[model samples]
Target chain A: MRHDVILRVIAKLLIPFILLFALYVQFHGDFGPGGGFQAGVILAAAVIFYGLIYGLADARKLVPEAVVESMMAIGVLIYGGVGVAGLLLGGNYLDYFVLDPNPVHGQHRGIFWVEVGVAVTVSGVMLKIFYMFADRGRVDE
Target chain B: MAVTVLVIARSRNLFGVIVLGGLYSFLMATVLVAMDAVDVAMTEASVGAGISTVLLLGALYLCKSEETRPVQAPWLPLVVSLAVGAVLAYGTLGLPEFSDPKAPIHTHVVPRYLTELKQEVDVPNVVTAVLASYRGYDTLGETTVVFTAGAGVIALLRRRRKDRKP
Candidate 1:
């Protein structure tokens, strides 16, 4: 792993752009061809790329296993919470029209938050799968 | 595409198979884009070419690179698959033509989405509007599935790690 100077350097340079692209896809889903699923995978790919070059242990240090586990639940909660918020706001379950003063803005706000939740959960799922598989032999008895 | 699948079928090396699978996924994504299913294409690209390839590579590390020969002949499974394919093909004969405006699928909800989507959601991408707002419940279900998969993986692997005695 240490001998591949080019791989490490190239990965370091590309990771930020990959992450930025993921964010762009997430926000631009309404107008373009991406959303939580694609953004989440891209985000996970960035982390996986980092792990491939710098080692999984370093990657885990940056996004701890426990934290990743928590994120899985947190994202789901965020998504469901929005629905619950809508319910509390006098709308039907998961309804976004009653979210704000204007139905249109509320729809936008609802979609944004829901996509954010999806991104978080998706990225968390991907990272969790990677961690489990990568750590299979390394996690010692 | 056919050539890649043939190569994948012939290859015994898991690594090569995974790489070819990623290539196949990339091709499928392109096909989806050509069909104007950009959102689905994006998902296929990310999930198929990106994460699954890496996951397969990770799994490959814990297993043998080359596949072992199977004891049974492939003829029976091949025949069964061909039979199923024939049945599916026959079934398709009763369905509507591709992009037919009169198709039941196009007639029901498609027209509504096409007509009122802009006025209702006002989003340019109707796919987003449908997934995030119009059919929000389905999206919620999908998010829950992803969350559940993550939780299941953690429970299976991380718990085993903790159980290992020092």
Candidate 2:
């Protein structure tokens, strides 16, 4: 379904702001209500909105299925790899204090990385699910 | 179905229903955050508002858009749902207040986490520390669930490409 020209333009204008807000939610997570997962979903929703108003083909052009699959794996790997890094340093799994001698910095770094991993996994999953249903719905139609 | 009930109760068209459902899920997520159950809220809001609704509308393509005139009244399901709702509400009445500083949840292993969490995990947000470190295995299982879901989606949406490769 092609959106009207005005609505499409409005969507285009709004997309960037939505994305910015998601990013803001992500970074401000420590003090605020949102964190990686919520931010990731909100980000994906903006992309999904783009997909909805424009054609799914255009959305796929921007975010391919293969990319989403890789992102899913990378997210887990990132999370686990951080833990493994701690293990290799003679600490137990996911013990990020050993990442650096300074505990505060270590916590900061670890949380950032973990949140990145979460964000990647979640956004990828959202897009992947969208493709699945949207594709199936198209075939059914 | 749930959508019909929502529409009937809320007085909205299908598009409005979808948007309202999203809003409702988000509000529920907010409640979860207020309870400091960030993980559950994240999953609920994402899966409920983001994916499930899309999937429902997609499935709707295979079926009727408008509700069919009921051949029989849905009194049984209605009663069952109401009973379940009442039971859930009643259950909540016995629970401790949200964010109660004096709640048993705050007095138990949580204090230990607040004290030694930095020494052990170096994460400021105690929730992440517990989720990823204190209970790392559970986080791994959760990740596995995501992987399994990805696999399920792949299997469900598989397409046969018949041009000689396999």
Candidate 3:
């Protein structure tokens, strides 16, 4: 495989900012037009762009398949865990207000955690799909 | 638009159809965005322009893409589709006008979403709040649907560990 110096530099430069922006969007969701879903997609798109310019193998090396799989599971677990937290706090499922003494702050905290779950799951799912499709040739072998 | 669709349908070359399909989807996405439905536009542009085009091309690799005349239209499919479309349009009549403040959708639940959304979910984008919290159950189901589709595709493509069955 031929290495494109420009693409490599671009990936190096953009990836950190992409990740930072994703976090910013995730956290600042309450104050802005961005949120978990958009952040997830943008984050995944950055990784996808890297995989496209580089190779899938390189992308996988950076983010291993096992890690991706575990993340997928962990995301769901986090989401479900929040509901359980609410239940334990004497509220119905996913009742964020009951999760803490201060209802407003509790809502904020719950949404933040939920957004994290969403970001992880979305990025994991998208990467999985990209890998499956790009790995089509290997499967045929 | 009709001309574009006809040309796409009539194209003999597979590549031409693929390009045309992308163009069609691009145009549709632009229209959606122009109409202020940015979310729908983003989805259409991504899935339709990006993924659908790739999937179609990939499928084309697995089969011949030469266009052949349809022998016959299934009368049942045609009737069912038209009937369903008519019913859907009829249902739309009762729906609130687009962006109308007085519409029930805009008046009640929608207003609450637009107004109290930030205070509750703390998200400025009410759509995201609605998708992730207000109606999160539905979003969870949607996420599961994506996961299910991925699993289904993986299962379909996976090979047995050993070739020998006996």
Candidate 4:
């Protein structure tokens, strides 16, 4: 793969667009057909594409294992924290109505954060699984 | 789609099987889209087709490329699968027609979601509104599940520096 010029060039051109599309799916989900789960998978797919073209080592360098691990936990925390925030605001658990003075605005805010949390964890888990599978049978440098 | 499955079933090469599996997923995604489940279609396309194929290939890299012949007769498993498929097909006979407006799904909670979505969540996509706001707890649970899966993989597959052979 490292020696394949055509694959390398094409991948280099495509990775950024793939990433951009993932972000589009993530943010535009509120209006369109995509959401955090789809966006997360697309994001991980971009990195995985990079890994396939370049190398696992390069992909690991791009998104470090520690960072991936932390992302997995941090996303869950973010989601749970939203619920806790709602509870603290004198609303039921996972309630979005009290997050802001305007209930509709609070709903938007809550959904946004929740989707972000979902995207983070999903991407992390996907990358982590890819890393684990690709790492197998490799010798230590 | 049926041809793809047949080819996959006949193929002994694991690589071809994985690629065909991706094809099946893509086809499934298309079917989902035809049924107007765009979000689910997107997910199926990305996860089932894209990532799962890559993961299967990665796993294949660590093992044999060709599948070995089964030691026992395949007839029993074949019978079981056919029976299950028949049962599933029979079950689908009881389902409402495609896009039936008066279907239970459309008449039940969907009406409320469709009517109140703008006022309640105010998102253009009802699916997103439902998943993130109306069923926030479920989404939270799903995120936690993903995290737990990642943790479990790390536990099983990660090799520490000290554990490596010198």
TM-score for all predictions? Answer: 0.95, 0.78, 0.78, 0.95
lDDT of each: 0.88, 0.75, 0.72, 0.91
lDDT tens string, model 1, A68-139? 888788888889999999999999998998998889889998998898899888998899899899888576
TM-score, chain B only, every model?
A: 0.94, 0.70, 0.77, 0.90
Candidate 1 local distance difference test against the native: 0.88
Instruction: Locate the minimum summed-lDDT window of 10 residues in model 2 chain A.
Output: A28-37
Give RMSD to native, each candidate: 1.6, 4.2, 3.8, 1.8
Cα lDDT, model 2, residue B108: 94
For model 1, the stretches where C-alpha displacement exceeds 4 angstroms are: none
lDDT digits (tens) for residues B97-149 of candidate 4: 98788989879888899999888888999999999998887888878888888
TM-score of the second chain of model 4 compared to its true counterpart: 0.90
For model 2, give the TM-score of chain B: 0.70
For model 2, what is the error of residue A107's alpha carbon versus the real structure, in angstroms, after optimal superposition? 2.2
lDDT tens digits by residue: candidate 3, A7-70: 7888889988978887776677766655666566667667766777788888889888787777
State the weakest 10-residue window (summed lDDT) of model 1 chain B.
Answer: B157-166
Candidate 4 chain A, which ten residues in sequence have the lowest lDDT sum?
Answer: A132-141
Kindly list the per-residue Cα lDDT of model 2 for residues A39-112, writing each as its tens digit: 77888888888999898999999888899888888888888888898889878888777888886677666777
Best by TM-score: 1
Deviation of model 1 at B128, angstroms: 0.8
